[model samples]
Target: MKVYGVVAAFWLSLASATILQNGQVRPNDYPSTAISAISSYNSSWHTYSPGSPELSYKGRWDHKYISWWSAPGLKFGFQADQVAISFGKYTSDGVLVAYRLGGQDWMLTNVTANSTHLFVTPSTTGYNLTTPTNVTQTLELRVTNWAYGVQIQCVHISGGAAKLVKIPDYTRTMELIGDSLSAGQYATLEGISSYSWGLLYGLGNVEFSITAYPGICLHEGRCYSNLHGQTAQWLKIPDTSGRALDIYGSDLADIPNWDFAAHPAADITVINIGTNDNNTANNVTATGYYNSYIQLINEIHTRWPQSQIIVISLWSGFSQVGNTWQQGAGFLDEIQNVVKYFNNGSLNGRGECSSCFVYYFNTTGILEHSDIGPLYHPTDVGHVKLASHLMQYIKLTFGWILEQTGPEVQHDTLYWNDEADY
Candidate 1:
């Protein structure tokens, strides 16, 4: 196992004005009504810079163009019959971006390299962005899917190009930490983005910061000789090497530290790791994993005392062993054991200790055979299934369910890739 001791410097963008204030959306983030929306339409494309306060940002850094790991997104209001977007693509055609405008149903489309993708909000029962329908329309977009590298420029409003007034409304936030199962694979159709999207639509008012990559582990040391542990990656931005580095940077030395104080502490943090630790050739022991995870838990506690940390086991259990119980040959038991240690062997530990910060949910049989993708990870179908169950769990345990249940997935573009092993 290789040890990494180098601490990367922090990179805080001066241009990220759309930043979260005190880890929460600034009240009435939208611009004052003193500056009215453009009542008339424009024949030319009206452009705005990404740093414009009119644009609200979350789960991302401020840059000339925005791109990073997990689901970096925006929420803003505008007046336009059509919207055109341009983005920078490093390797693959930046695709699988999810969007909703004019309160319409969610739509999925690919933002091809060096090209402008035009989006026309369809006429739903309540929404129609056209001249007669409404004076202003709000747009919510998230690059739930990552395609190697992406740099999103500004949006161009064709007709009613009003100043983008970003409005963020959320009661709490969630931080999802994991590896390939959490981060989509190379050119994967949709990462666990659907899961986050499901939570967004179902819960109605919450935010998610996805701190995950293709091949990471919870314990230190290494996995695939590249992925560093969560302790290292959590504080840095993701690079192109299936790792986290500065978005413009190319190597580990250029990795930039993420500012936790600038962002909000997670009300709920879901940790799904350990698969790589067990699968790696390093032959990590459960004791080693136990210690490392304890470290992770300790850090989380120190950062957010009132946070609920849910540790989940790997979905893909190893090959059937002994015929007694069909599951993986990895650290599923040990992972749960660590949770039990904190819970004092009591399944309902919260009742015993009001301050108990840890909880465990065994996902041994979460995914069905068909839902499992080729890489031994959950496919789009599998992700939705997983999200549904997670939502159900949160509702039952903490009574946090809202009106909506799940996102309306785009059937045509529904194959997302994930997971990896030698």
Candidate 2:
């Protein structure tokens, strides 16, 4: 496979068109190895561009240092299926992590304040994710953080261009199942920024999937309701019978299926739900939610017995019923204990300490805006801070090798054209 260039203009023009069949994973030439080499930072060229005319933030905005490198002749069409992404710990505030393909949002996932703080120690915490449909596309990792200090490595990608059209390569996959956060709203436009992007960019070597709904909760089918002074949608019944956008119900239509094609040969699964659980009056029982979480882990294990499971908390946003400092902290502690009890197996030496395997990320920062979005969701900066925290932990837990990517290729600056902008 012949690799290509890494110039700013190259990436900008490259990003414009449908980047299909340009990213592929080969097993023969590619060895199943973890990258642990670190690359020195270049202040001038290792960070994301300052701002975008189309996007704005309410909190302080700053980007972290990032580096990457692509393989030769490894052109993936916009239709290559089964793309896997994993990465090292990202240590920065409010960072947006993801593995991007062309412009479409695949393997949509994020590391919130809670996930970041819980696992942000000096270790790497990661997930194996896959996309729902089969599309040939380029695999690119993007980060959104204020400052930077971490290394990322792509471990694996399965199959060729036609792999997606037939049956998506079944390498282990993790479903980012949750509400708007997982669905990736205001977080960043589809291809611009996302938690899934970080997963993809960091773990450029794995195949994963995404099963997120814009306004979904874990209570079967529901939305988040107001908890504390915040207003979160609740899980309710949608009025399909009526026309206007008034009626609401559990709408899992956007949820992906369990077909073999969609399911990868996953060995690591992650579930980050529950914020919306406390949204409505019919709040899901913490114990019951814990029980259901265990069952979900079991079901996934049954499919991929050797897989490692991780249950993450929602990024900080609205407070729940008893969200006072001490009460909230205690509630999370209990949830963490329950997760450990379920997935604590024999020492498997997956690198991370088994005891700390099942993790928890709490929203540490207070939101600056109470009404950023319609239902009072966090603004772009809020998501960035959360991603930064999670990336830090992932790097520490997994000593990932850094990619020797050239200067931070600011696509906007490279492709800026006064004539194009009216």
Candidate 3:
């Protein structure tokens, strides 16, 4: 896996306050005031005040690709033409910003790391807003990039007068943990795992967190170093260094650990791992893998006592080590046995978690050789299929109300064609 470094750069200054599009320049203005990151409307993993407009930090390893902060049911008093956001970084693969205006569907746009200031208007470069103006409206924005950390300073509105209003309380909360698939490594255009799943589960009114990284494993160490050791232990930490601070290094202060109390405990925690552990290089035995996985689940239970642990079977095509798949069938069977053992109250190593369950998804149709590249990461279509299957399981298990007819379609014009396999 490639290590990411902090770039010392600044955003390009806007030549004009208003954006020019389709031969017309709209009037624009900076928000009269800003919302502090600590406000209830702004929900994130870490709270740090770097400067003005207190920032919310999202560590690189904690929720790289699919982590998001949203303000739902925000009522604007007057017509607002555009929204601007300020971030700490401005580079490539920076962040994907999606918003839902009023009662309409959600729309998506990309935010680069080169520019700390992001301006989104009806006549924005990539997407156009369809919600009617000059009326009370609600907006929600989600971050989609997973490579580096981001600190969202504040959200700004322009064009007309408006004020930030209270958002309704969410009924349920969720947390997702895994490796590259969950971190959205290859599927750059429209495949942040949590985004796809959020749409599938109709999670507009739910608060959620995604904790994952590329090439991380359950039993084996991280993709980069063997010293990292086990996904469970790493989950407790804050950031994983791509450079000086690693498992082998003696740098302790460089890497910081996370505080579990920063965010509220989730109602449901879905874990999708073991793909890297099943790799031929890891050489993990069935017994070792099972024991390590059970230990990880127990740790999760202990951390979030009220959460319902749902272990997802690894998707197919990830076990290809040589001419044939390495741990495709056998590893799945082992995982099933582990789940059964936990459910039957046989392996209660860490206190019994009665709500623990297993979800075995059929990945035959979703993970096709053509869909995934040589590295075995899922494409946008593959992610959508995975989300569909997981959505079915959530509906059957929790009986969540299906508000929409189908999954929300994302219209993204900025597609990444040359993403490197980590």
Compare the candidates by TM-score and give the number of the best one.
Answer: 1
lDDT of 2 by residue, 1-422 (tens): 00011111221322232221113221222112122221221111111121322112111111321221110001122232234333334322223343334433322233322121111111112212334234334444443221121233222233333232222332433333344454344333322334543343334344444333333345443332211110111111111111102212223343122343323445445556555555434456776556655555555656566555555554334443554421122236435655656546322323235444444444435333332333334344454454455546555554433331442212211234579757
Cα displacement (Å) at residue 357, model 2: 5.4
lDDT of each: 0.58, 0.34, 0.48
What tens digits encode model 1's per-residue C-alpha lDDT throughout 1-422?
11111101111211122323224543323211111122233356677766667676667554545556666666777665555555644423534466666455566554545555555434423344355234666776666554244565666666544445567657688887776666643212344335544553456567777666555567775555344677666666553343133244434456666667777888888887777676545566778888888888878778788788888766553354465435453576677777877777765633223556677766646765556544455556666777778778777766786655344433233445775753
Better of 1 and 2 by TM-score: 1
Q: Across residues 1-422, which tens digit of lDDT does each residue of candidate 3 receive?
A: 11111110101211123333223563333222223333343332222222322222322223222122121111222235555554544223434454445544555544544233433456543333434244545555545444433444344555544333335445677777765667665453323443334442354455555665555567745444423444434444533323213222434444445567766677777777776666655566778889887787777777788777667666546444678543244377777776677677443433224455543443444555555543456655566666766666666666776554543444332346686875
Clashes of each: 5, 103, 6
Displacement of the residue 119 alpha carbon in candidate 1, Å:
2.5
Scored by lDDT, model 1 comes in at 0.58
Better of 1 and 3 by TM-score: 1
Q: Sort by lDDT, best first.
A: 1, 3, 2
Clash pairs (backbone) in predicted model 1? 23-264, 238-244, 239-245, 317-328, 318-328
Q: Point out where model 3 deviates above 4 Å.
A: 1-82, 89-118, 121-136, 188-204, 220-222, 225-234, 237-254, 318-327, 345-371, 404-422
